[model samples]
Target: MAFKHKSTLLILTAGVFSCTPAWAASVSVVGLFKDKAIVSIDGGRPRTLSVGQTVQGVKLVAADSGSASFDVDGKRRTLGMGQSFAGGAQPGARQSVSLTADARGHFAAAGSLNGYPMTFLVDTGATSIAISAAEAKRIGLDYKAGEVTGVGTAAGVVPAWRVKFNTVKVGGITVSQVDGMVVETGLSVPLLGMSFLNRMEMRRDGQTMTLTQRY
Candidate 1:
């Protein structure tokens, strides 16, 4: 009886992590069909995206189960699910959210708060998510690199400090009042970090990474 009980436990454990194979979270779009959300194309050329919707270039293409096939700019593409879009919401919530990066390591989004549309880079290396001093000026944040503050990085101890951005957007998402430090001086690109990321739907698609915020 003990042996049987042990076998049952193992089965249960496996079952717990193993979700429906149809929607296993995958972050690639080659030859499979995924539930792709088209956001933008031509890098926001032509007309800008309207509010209350995703951009026009977000494509989820793949032929695997739950693979996605859709059109963008009159072009056909295939996509696949990076992860199950279900069961990824707040308790008793009805809305779902997801983000799939393209071959160029870009997750496209088109959204505006108070009538301002913004783009962002989804960077995981940032310790606390940051923006450049210049961007800080744009977002209305007082982003002045203060005394050389010390921070850790893959290279080694580097000079860094905090600079606020007016706003940063990723996965058709946005966050405000975000405080993050710099890695090296004179670098002027916005880095998305986990500081504001902790509230979103976070998951890994192997070499592919995804962040979706469902409100």
Candidate 2:
């Protein structure tokens, strides 16, 4: 028993001593409302995060001035107000990024909104951006997953459910915590509703799409 205890102590000591400089530390930040910022880590090690990059297991500390930072391998990388760290790396940092595609106007891009992969079909006629029953189910939505509720359609009352999106981004525009609806009437297509379109400047022409927004 004494030998076992000594071995356990040694193992614990190694664990504590082996904490890597790359292991991120706890970070704190102050952010301003309506302000935005970008951050880099590990002295910007990877150099840059390209467009449409998915990131998790990362940290972002926001401040009142729209600046933020995260810990990298036991170090803190702070950002300034209105600064951009989205596409490029800083000195001695690991690469991180947000997934943003560049499609404008009435175009389609596959993305994970609300933590689910979906094909967004740009539509101006949709009252709000909408989704099909099949696509909604993949994102853990309750089409058949929950009790059906009433939804009004051009035909009449149809069944629908209130849904939530964990993340929503299009052409560099993003919003979170948005309330959405899942409809079941044999919708062959997932409609890109206004809930997303109202957030951007979309211009469409013959076979071309243009989208513009302020980052």
Per-residue CA lDDT of model 1 for 98-186, tens digit only, reads: 44555544443323222233333445544566443454455454444444465543444445665544444442344565556544533
Off by over 4 Å in 1: 1-97, 104-116, 145-160, 163-176, 182-188, 205-210
Q: What overall lDDT goes with each candidate model?
A: 0.38, 0.42
Tell me, by TM-score, which candidate is best.
Answer: 2
The TM-scores of all predictions, comma-separated, are 0.42, 0.44
Q: Per model, how many backbone clashes are there?
A: 34, 29
Q: Candidate 2 lDDT, tens digit per residue, 92-182? A: 5442212222323224533346644344555555555566576776766654644456555554555776666667644234457655666
User: Which candidate has the top score in lDDT?
Assistant: 2
lDDT value, candidate 2, whole model:
0.42
Which stretch of 10 consecutive residues in model 1 shows the poorest summed lDDT?
1-10
Evaluate model 1: give its TM-score. Answer: 0.42
Per-residue error (Å), model 2, residue 4: 70
Provide the clash count, candidate 2. Answer: 29
